[model samples]
Target: MVRAFKNTLIIFSSLLFCFAQQEDSLKVGLQSLKKIESDVIIISAEVRSGNLNPTAYRFSVFPRHRPSEVYISRMFFPGDSLQVVLPENILDADSLANIASLEPVGGSFEKSYKLFSKQSDVIDLGIFDVKKKSDIVKLSVVDGQTGSPVLKPTIKIFQLGKVLYQTVLDSSGYGRLRIPIDRNREIPLYALIDTDGRYPLWRGSIEVSQGVSSITLALNSMSLMIGESLFRVRSDLTPFRKGPENGSEILFMLSKDDHIVISRSAGNKLYGRVRLDLHTKKSSNFFHGWIRTKDVEYLETFATDTNHD
Candidate 1:
């Protein structure tokens, strides 16, 4: 009886801790949601503890691209008031912020401005016309300082608010996208890099027009993961904005066994991957594999067993 009580206490404690974390996260998200009230918003979070003394860490806020009228967002530190954190060094970092290093903190148009066919600005496959492909928005991420193509990065497509498709970017940092268009569709279509939920380093948006034949968007140059692996991948669901998350959950079980990746490990801890694996399933395309966290966790448990033995 005592042992069962102890286990119950442990589970309760874990659940309470998780609840608190989620609540705090929601508060932070609320702060962010209040700030974006413009067409384009760019924010960067910088951690500075260096010789720069005036402000240790700051964030640069861009309401628009004028460069003159800048708004620095306030980073709330628990008990502290929401203080403006965007100082000079931080802004400079944003200008040169690499893909992996830059923990960006901004979002474009709110849920108000429509970005697609008369629907909300989220990604859900069910509401879209599956076969209606009219416009193709192409963005090529490249080295920022050097005008060369960034080879590989993970890119995802969202409709409504769900992930429809994702792929590793090609040698040109380009993810060729096809989104269906209806006359009711509005402008301000969003393009984002899925790494940390960032706005498109480059973008394309329209005002939901009725006077166009077919539209093509070209994204500006940006730097992504320099060492991100570019493995051969094939999937029936390409990064089309109008595809289902999992085609047929019952056509096969949703087990984690199908996933495999060539991830590098650091001292029994796997951070991510620079060289990944790709597999071709039956009657489908070969698609790049993800670093399976479940597999890694299982490995960690096995390592513990090995140590005990």
Candidate 2:
């Protein structure tokens, strides 16, 4: 009887030891899993647009190095927060931050935000406001000299040197755009009209009022004297010199899409004038210099009967 009791006690002790070892192993495994999870980061943000259908928009995250490998979230409502998971080491040394974009379906009106570094594993971006399509204003483009509508014009609206909206006008030269309004009830925006090389590029700034419904853009005609002709600067940062010689001093630089009125040509050089601001009426804004004929492309000639003596 004494031998049997000792055997049973030993067996119980061994079983207890086995159970303790298994518990320790499980604890170590769980710790390793948690350590791996800590190497990742979570980004969250709430997007809202007043009275707009939130289902029409989606969120996306573009990794800095691998832009093609994007992370997208499911459709979220107005009040719901968007979440994205990324590895902590996703940012490289050359990149400052990753880019997150909120885009609507079937449209190019996208808003982007930068994802910066955070010490915490979770980063929360505050509410992001999206502009609604209902905040629109009608636009009418017409010729300043002729008072005729510019048919089927390509229009681009800019704010702070960034393109906010772009669309082509209909046959009536009319289009509508959603203008973002600020707290001041007025926003200064620029409009660029392209008539398919029919006229010089028209750029002008206008003050948009929140209460205004429609605005008209008056584009100046490309007018030149009898001896003058129109040429477009073909290259960016082309040098405009003081004289026709290659050793002449560079008076200024002209960029691509800038129009020049050429009066005469000497050897490989052309004397031309560039209007600094076509919308402005100041005569001092006209800068005349010599540009190489290789840098400009002839658009049209403006010879009239008045050139006859």
Candidate 3:
């Protein structure tokens, strides 16, 4: 009996020691995790407006031409606050203060407006509303180069930063929309057209009265100087230059999948053009600049090309 009691005590002592070692290791692991987490920092931001609760709005932050963007979540309310923790050097390396509220007023527009962040961590976003209706406007959309009817062209009707209506044109390249205007008062309205969101085709404005009006719009091509060779960006984040040489000024950045049609070549740089629809996918602006030959991978060689293994 004495020997059995001694063996049982030894087994119990060994278990206690093992348990103590495991508890100490677990505590060390938790301490290491806490130290690593301390390095992460989060910034609190708020979106405010006088008329509407800006908390309902979704925000996207990005550069002028880059596709990648930081989406601010909608977890904040009552105070219209949000938490932002950008990647390292993203603020200094690229622009992030530009805020575009992805909220569509009356369910139409989705353009990014510039919002400067202040030291108080607040972003002031203004609100807009549609005005009264007074005019029946008719327009035809056609290809600028070929005069061909652009089928299914998207037309966005906007006034004072607020989108009133969005419609796709009929097969005849024609569409009509009512503009909100008061009689004897000339209110300005804008229209943006695109072909299936692939490219921004045209952007124009109109002055409306209490009467019917008609106009014809010519759609711009995504490619510059058609009948030339076309090429796609070889890599993402390729910079468009102002001249053909190295150290040339960067005009803008292009995505790798975006297509470009070469207009001409000077020295080692190729002059090209592109039309961007921006974030709204409505209004499009034109850009013409130089690109280095080495920066682009050829989709097709020129007609004067010679074979070289």
Candidate 4:
């Protein structure tokens, strides 16, 4: 009986030692986590808008190059504010200049804020006015050459790199785009029209006015002149030069994947035009300039017919 009692006591002592070690390890781990959390940068903002629901929107913070490391805010109530935590160690100095965006769950519009590099721990952005989707814009897409409706076209409206609205047009090439209004005024946005790869993509900036309801877009068709060939910019920051040579002055810079219509070519240089704005009137809003041949790739070419007017 004495030997049995000693064995039982030894087993109990060993179990107690193991539990104590585990408890110490857990406490160390928690301390390490707390330290890490304290080292992060927190961005807090109160969303202010009529009929605002905290659960219906989300806040995101991420580096431009490292989108996978994006930190999103958790769902909170109306009175509680939204907070986004960005770890300092994981991001470099350049990545510290991140982008903070607020978007709705249904994706009506996205408002982006550029975060400057600051050493502060907590950055409090005062009441952010979230725009509500209260206005409607009617669009009519037609063929540029024929002046007839382009049936069943797909339309996508973009604002700050996010698709604000997407819809397919009806048989009459008409679509009503529902978008957000800011301060009861007009806002500049982008529009992209696709016709199931039948025609070249029509992309241009547009001004959405508060009271204006309708706009028309004309898409150049494949039956047009061969000089109207479409080309897409192959590199970012491609300069639109005033002349064909490298020594020419740059009118503006074009982003990668921007489509342009080539009008002419002068040895290794191409003269093209990009649509700057889409208007309801027939007057053109294109920016015509010269770009290097190496900076763009041929997308499509229409048939050679200069007689049709």
How does each model score on lDDT? 0.34, 0.72, 0.60, 0.73
lDDT of 3 by residue, 1-309 (tens): 999999999999999999999999999989988766554434444443434333244545544444465544344334454455543334323335545444423333223355534222233444422123346778788776688888888888777778867888899898887664433244567877767434333556755544788877776544434345556666778899877777888988886546566768988778877667655434667678888777776554332333222
Model 4: which ten-residue window has the lowest total lDDT?
300-309
Q: Rank by lDDT, descending?
A: 4, 2, 3, 1
TM-score of each model, in listed order: 0.22, 0.50, 0.38, 0.42
RMSD per candidate (Å) reads: 31.2, 14.9, 21.3, 17.2
- The Cα error of candidate 4 at residue 28, in Å, is 75
| lDDT digits (tens) for residues 179-210 of candidate 1 | 44442354234444432212122222332233
Error of 2 at 292 (Å): 1.3
Q: What TM-score would candidate 3 get against the native?
A: 0.38
Model 3: runs farther than 4 Å from truth?
A: 1-133, 182-187, 197-200, 222-227, 231-239, 244-247, 250-259, 263-271, 274-288, 291-309
Worst 10 residues of 2 by lDDT: 300-309
Ranking by TM-score: 2, 4, 3, 1
Give, for candidate 1, the lowest lDDT window spanning 10 residues: 109-118
Deviation of model 4 at 235, angstroms: 4.9
Off by over 4 Å in 2: 1-131, 182-187, 247-251, 278-285, 300-309
lDDT of 4 at 60: 70
